[model samples]
Target: QLHNFCSIELGSFYLDIIKDRLYTMPADSIGRRSAQTAMYHLLQALVRWLAPILSFTAEEIWQHAPASDDSIFLQTWYELPELSSAGALNDADWQRIIELRNWVSRELEVVRNKGEIGAALEARVELWLAPADYDLLQKLGEELRFVLITSDAEVYPLTEKPAEVAEEQLGVAIRVVPLEDAKCGRCWHRRADVGQSAEHPQLCGRCITNLGDGEQRHIA
Candidate 1:
């Protein structure tokens, strides 16, 4: 059965992808998310094909798939009905989004190179897009924002040359700049002037208190 071979192969393949090179696909290819997506689709096709035969195990696997809500058998067939329609699922759209994400990720990598890790996603990105591109990106809202590892983001027309900002080149290219003199002390993110915690004035107040407890525990 498809499941029999796939279950064994997938575990090994996914681990290899993760441990060896999942994050390092050619920058010119689709981004990390697309790599994840391709793996997911491969498994999904295998699961559904096997569900009719393997029954129980396929459902178990499907249940764990992100955003899958129904029984695998009850879900729509793998093939989409809208392929011939005007709004047919387009490969170009997916490629564009993935490319944009890859571009953004490279920019974040530059920040990491500067000895920072885990910047608060919402506070660290400022996207400058051509007018048409800005309009296209705004439609994605926060889902795309998170994919780019920014806590919050806003899209703007590229009116003039961007201010001197750090940049990274992936499939496309992206720029990253430090936010204003804001800082979140607890997490060490660069937005300290937010939320309402006065006790740790330079730190985001929430993390300040949370860290207090963790610090006490560490001391003991």
Candidate 2:
């Protein structure tokens, strides 16, 4: 089960989710810090899990881990964070958001494979979603772009499925369009306002925001 967890879930998460945030956000931004904290916690938990079987490797990992723990034997399972039920977005909402993101990702992959876009970041995505789903994603505001790993993402409230879509897939539809704007040298995301600023003409507007106060991301 753990092997499958690592191979499938964590595999998609690290590559498709965390990597985007880490690469784009500034060094000291809250988003980057959040990703780093998640990675650290995951490492500690995994090291504990492997202590009995891969004793030498677990011990080696423990040695270089953040805290000054003497040995793997001296540790307990990593304490998970307390779950919040009263938040604006709950666990169910996040699961739904993941489902929605998967649809966008598949469409982006199709666009990339067609040679119309070099990367997800080179295209803008438009998501047409059921009213509830649209409202749920809009709570993320602009952070939805980061989650989809697209240059820009636009969500529209929708009611009915198109003729080609299956009945079960009624709530979601995605369209990808290649972007022709200048690419940011730092983040590599193409944007129309990339060259608007003379001081740093090659960077996107978001990059400029990150340079000073950093982007405020509540959810992704």
Candidate 3:
């Protein structure tokens, strides 16, 4: 159970946060900082929690962690924060998002098998949903694209079913198109604005805005 908590639950949660929220947000933005800070603390707690079963490995990780003490075994047992805490995703909301994501993944796989797109990030997705699902899906806003791991996403009310529609059970249809925009050199997200900036010609608009001062620092 502990291994599943660390490897599956925590791992997927962190990956979703990074891909959807952290990477998409401007580096200097408060939202990005808050997300990164939460991830840092979660990882710290995870290392300490795992120390009992993974003593040597956990201690090695703890030793290298900033502000960590002599031994991870000396640390108190990890306690998860309340669900109402900042940056927390409610269980129901996450379940709905996961279902939508799975729908997109199924469609992406169809395209991938035909060698139409190499990666989910390399495709643009169009989502058609029943009128009943529109409001719930709209609640996701722009984050829907990130959840689907696509270069672009467009949501529309379900009309006549197209031959390419992926799933019928959830009243959701997906269409994948190869992303036409050049991929940003820094972040690798395909964006039409990639070469528009004169100063940062190789970067997307988001990367250009975040790369202020251009002074690189190694985190380790």
Candidate 4:
């Protein structure tokens, strides 16, 4: 049954169904990214079987799945993580990380509102931490910055005030600054535009469908 279920059309349809349900459900029901990532794992499982049948389509979808690298064909087949005995991730870790990510999004949006537009992960950021959380921040500075969508980040001394503060004190503050002259017109994030016409200024080839900034262009 599992072998039979793997195919490009089937895999994509499965993702569509799960994504639709996840987005349509109440926010309190589940985390959207978590649901989507679970869908990615399912798709990855099917990718091996589907790659020979639907090479192009599988690659296309795989590229959009952030968890994947260049080509699913190049990547090894998915193996279910063995969780039989003791080693396993618990819900609390996921919850804590989710909360941190949400807070990072909120803070990043606030910084972006202050004319930082399109500040992506890998942008230099300064994080102000509470004294109690300073050591933790120092230990995970790179990881936190990467997850929070910042270039480089440093956990500053506790007294630094964040531009936006949550209703309930997060005891953490973040500041993001876009690197100068590193803008890609397409994704608007700082990166080498792999697909730019000679005439275009830093446009990503992969993001051709995302033409016209600040304008809603329906892809479907």
Q: What is the C-alpha RMSD of each candidate to the true structure, in Å?
A: 12.6, 2.6, 4.9, 14.7
lDDT tens digits by residue: candidate 4, 53-166: 889977887888766787878988788655444533344543454464566567668767776656454366665667755664454534454344454466776576654733
Pitting candidate 2 against candidate 3, the one with the higher lDDT is 2
Estimate, for each residue in 91-163, the C-alpha lDDT of model 1 and write its tens digit.
5754565566656666677776785644535245676666655666766664344445454466665654365
lDDT of 2 by residue, 99-212 (tens): 877777788788788999988999998777888998898888887887778889988766544456332377677778899988999888888889998999988888888888
TM-score of each: 0.45, 0.86, 0.78, 0.39
Position 115, candidate 1: lDDT: 56
Q: Identify the runs in model 2 with alpha carbons over 4 angstroms from their true place.
A: 83-85, 160-168
Ranking by TM-score: 2, 3, 1, 4
Candidate 4: RMSD to truth? 14.7
lDDT of 3 at 211: 61
Per-residue CA lDDT of candidate 3, range 1-220, in tens? 8878666555654465455446545666665666677777887888977877888999899998878887888888767665554644467756666677777788889889999889888988887888756666676677666666677788888885576665547688777889889998876779899999888889887677666532221110
Taken over the whole model, the C-alpha lDDT of each candidate is 0.53, 0.80, 0.72, 0.53
Relative to the unseen true structure, what is the C-alpha lDDT of residue 131 in candidate 2, on a scale of 0 to 100? 83
- Considering every candidate listed, which one attains the maximal lDDT? 2
